[model samples]
Target: MPQHLLLIEDDARLASMVAEYLEQSGFSVNHCGDGLSGLAHLTQPPAGAAPELVVLDLMLPDIDGLEVCRRIRALPAPLSTVPVLMLTAKGDAMDRIIGLEIGADDYLPKPFEPRELLARIRAILRRKVDNPAPNGKTLRFGTLEIDRDARTVTVAGAACDLTSYQFDLLVALAERAGRVLTRDQIMEAVRGRELDAFDRSIDVHMGRIRAAIEADPKDPKRILTVRGVGYVFARQQD
Candidate 1:
């Protein structure tokens, strides 16, 4: 079955163009012109047609994309875990960073090619299907537990809030515990693409992960930085 997608965009012309393009690419596209309707659609999807992903716009008529993402994450399980790909016209890196910090799976700046949008959507969905961790395999480092099959992370038996992409990043680093992997290597491992030179999204995700699992995000103990050598998951941890 073709994957279903929900697009929350206020720009009618752009929404039509994106929805049409995605439908042509074999996805079932449901477009909402405002944030409220988008949330309502997600909350009450048609039978057997729950969206596998969301294409969200930063600028909306009702509420901005960031708030919408936060509300989505706050939903009950399964719904909350659905992947989101953010679209933004803002050239400011901060907007994208904030989006990632709040649980967006990925983001594309405005004026992007529809093909790139399609590619990004496919990549995010692929991560959902092609999980890097083997089924039923759980990685444990002290108090931190990563259950691959369940796609969940817990610290000391308490659930850690992590987006789908953030969970994958933590898994990648944990799987290669104690090895220093550069930013490019990390992105390649998780996203199947090298990190762009100017992209700090990976770092932002790392911060979110740390905030979830670490005793203190500012002074992280589980995921450590190696000065100029990228990051390493400390094999030895509390």
Candidate 2:
């Protein structure tokens, strides 16, 4: 099946153009002009299709774009892993930083080139699919069990739902627990080679992971910061 797309943009003209263009590109597109319906549409998995990517406008008629993004992030499973590319006029440094920080995989400013959006969509999808994830396949960390094949992780009998990226990140740290992995190293291991401005994205991803796995993200005992060097997944087998 072709990749699916959910577009939540309030502009009628923009929405129509984007939907038509994406459909021509062999992607099945669903367009919603308001945020409420857009979010409601995602609550249940589609009968036969789920979106592979979402293009969300930051300004919505009902819910704000950031809330929509967070709600999407809170979703359990395949949905959570779906890449979200934010649409906003706020494309400056701080806006971009916050978007990535708040869980968007990518953000595009208004008046963007259609071609650029398409390219970014491809990149995000490829990044997700090509990365090696050790969770669903299988993992054994004492009483901690990760079944990547099933997309489930359990620690001490408590089930924890994690995004695909989060699970993969944890697996990398678990595999090298006690070893310090620089930001660049972690990026290479989990998210491909380090990009010039991709460091903050890593921090956000790690923070999300720590929130899921650690009892505390503020002062984590599981994943520790090594001051200026990088991070170390605390050695648990001591």
Candidate 3:
């Protein structure tokens, strides 16, 4: 089946251009020009027509993209799992960081190279299929819990929603608790590939996971940064 893409951008020309390019790249693209309409379209997709990916624009006519992302995360199945790539004209690091902090799988500045957007989209999809830990499987460690099978994580049994990357990071650390895995090892284990740019995406994912599952993300107990080596999940004796 051809992968489906939902592009939510208010700019008519940009929306058309992206749809055409993505379709040319073998994707079935759907465009929603306004935030309210985008949410409406998302609420009612075609029969069994969940999108494989979403391209979200930060500035929307009705609601901000950040709010949309939040709502999407609050969704169940198909919609919640759909990978999102945020588009913003803001190039500042803070803006980029905010997008990531708000659960965007990836971020691209406006006037981005089409190829780069496609690369990111492909990378996210690859990670989604290749990672395979977010299908409602749960792994528990003391007060910490990871439910990949349901994609629902809990800290002290409190429900938490995690992105695909965040879930993989926790699983990597938890699955190898008490042992130090180098950043490279964690990357390979989570991404299933050798690093191309050696990006700190692993660290970013870890931050999000810890923020969700730890009482203190700054000083996490469940997942510990081992200074020079890498990271280890704090072993809890059964």
Q: Please rank every candidate by TM-score, starting with the best.
A: 1, 3, 2
Can you write out model 3's per-residue Cα lDDT over 129-231, one digit (the tens) per residue? Answer: 6645544466777766776656567777787668876676677778778899988998777654354453465677678877887787887777788887888
Model 1's lDDT to the true fold? Answer: 0.91
Off by over 4 Å in 3: 76-78, 131-138, 143-152, 155-158, 181-185, 192-204, 228-230
TM-score of 1: 0.96
Which of the numbered candidates is closest to the native, going by highest lDDT? Answer: 1
Candidate 2 weakest ten by summed lDDT: 190-199
Best of the candidates, TM-score: 1
Off by over 4 Å in 1: none
Summarize candidate 2's per-residue lDDT along 1-238 as a digit string, tens digits. Answer: 8888889998999899988888888888888888788877777547765778889998898888888888887877767767789887844556666766667877788888898788777766766675365345666666567665565678677877565556666777777778998878876676543456543667777787777666667977777889888888866621
Please provide, for model 1 over 1-238, each residue's C-alpha lDDT reduced to its tens digit, 9 standing for 90 to 100: 9899999999899899999999999999999999999999999998877899999999999999999999999998888989999998758788898999899999999988999999999998888877686645899999999998889899999998888888888998999999999988888888755567688888899999999999998999999999888999999999
TM agreement with the true structure for every prediction: 0.96, 0.78, 0.81
